[model samples]
Target: MSDLLRRVATPCIGVCSTGIGDDVCRGCKRFCHEVIHWNSYSQEQKRIIDERLDQFLVQVMQDKLHIINAELLAWQLGVQRVRYPAQKDPYIWLFQLLRAGAGQITEPRKYGFVVDSVWRDSSLMELREAIDREFYLLSQAHYERYIGRYMQKEG
Candidate 1:
């Protein structure tokens, strides 16, 4: 397959909220400009964005949980029909695994994850809430770092 054909797909989850003044898409956490210009970006540009997102997610997951059986976790996510991109980012898989196992992941370690005290001491809903909060915070920081500069030029 050609490079374009083999490129990883956009991470859009269909819940686009960027058009409503949100700096980041709640679904995919991409900056508004990134979403708007995604189709116009070159493969290298797209890869850069993907890598940045992966880095953020990896930071969150590593700080909050430890995966012991990564293979089994991936299999579990697959069995549950969680739709994750084909990229090799473990954090993406971890996100899907948490979403799929929500409420039912009482013993995360069995699935190869060791929940950090930040999450271990909280209920499932609380954990999910914390993750969402942290994710959005990271997204906002990213938007400020990248897009804020352009905004200053326009003012």
Candidate 2:
């Protein structure tokens, strides 16, 4: 999703909590400053932000699911019109698929992924919520460890 300048786009989902002074946006889990400066950031900065989010997703997802067919996963996301960054790891697109259309997905295999047997009892929507919760917590912790220290020192 290219923004005005055709650079790397924001991850904003429009449910931003940053305006209310949250250290992290509940929607995309971006630090408030990251959200505020996203459009002004160089492509490299944007890529770093994206990779951080992707790494967090990888942490939370772990072996809970696996992408069996990268092309099929990409195709499914395209077919669903899920907004995801282009040229990223297929797992990023997998997260986008779950975020946008988890409820509509009943069978993981058909979507070119496999839910671990231990997680099979949970629905995709449930897994999506779990992932979102964990991701947000990780982002909040990161802020408190890094950015929050500087903020506290200034104030």
Candidate 3:
């Protein structure tokens, strides 16, 4: 479990092509210019983009949660056909990590899925145990990466 919850960095390799109308790259899902000049952007500019990305990510996760909750309701109502909730939406924790900006601007999808899948199957106490373990590990990693970047200034 601890091994499955490790953090990884953003996988962007500078391949960016913003869509024609949306101004966001279909390849990297960021504005093309932001992708092109990511290395050159000031910390302030990067932080702004990161914040917007966080919001977009949260919305994506919220949509998944809604879909999962609706499916759970349907199952409870004795729907004739029900999709596997685990397969349908298994990345909720990843979205939480994105919102929290763990690892200083990265999404460790593999670990996120492992934790989320475990969470979906566990009872309340079991889930809480998993969350506590995963959160403690991940939070420590986040602290190591970002506390010096932001919090130490205040300290």
TM-score of candidate 2 on Cα atoms, chains taken together: 0.86
Of the two candidates 2 and 3, the one with more favorable lDDT, higher being better, is 2
Total backbone collisions for each predicted model: 2, 0, 0
Angstrom error at residue 44, model 1? 1.5
Query: How much is 124 displaced in model 1, in angstroms?
Result: 2.9
Most accurate candidate by TM-score: 2
In model 2, residue pairs whose N, Cα or C atoms come closer than 3 Å (at least 3 residues apart or on different chains), thus clashing, are none
**Candidate 2 per-residue C-alpha lDDT over 1-155 given as tens digits, one digit per residue, 9 for 90 to 100:** 44434566678888999999899999999999999999888888897887898898888876578889888887887888887766667778898889788999988888899987888899999888988898999999998998999999999
Residue 91, model 2: Cα distance from true site in angstroms: 1.1
How far out, in Å, is residue 120 in model 1? Answer: 1.2
Q: 2 or 3: which has the higher TM-score?
A: 2
Ranking by TM-score: 2, 1, 3
- Write down the RMSD of all candidates, one decimal each: 2.3, 3.1, 15.8
Give stretches of model 2 more than 4 Å off: 1-6
| Model 3, residue 78: C-alpha shift (Å) | 35
Q: What is the Å distance of residue 132 in model 2 from its true position? A: 0.7
Q: Scored by Cα lDDT, where does model 1 land?
A: 0.77
TM-scores, each model vs. reference = 0.85, 0.86, 0.34
Candidate 3 versus the native: TM-score? 0.34
**Candidates' C-alpha lDDT:** 0.77, 0.85, 0.41
TM-score of 1: 0.85
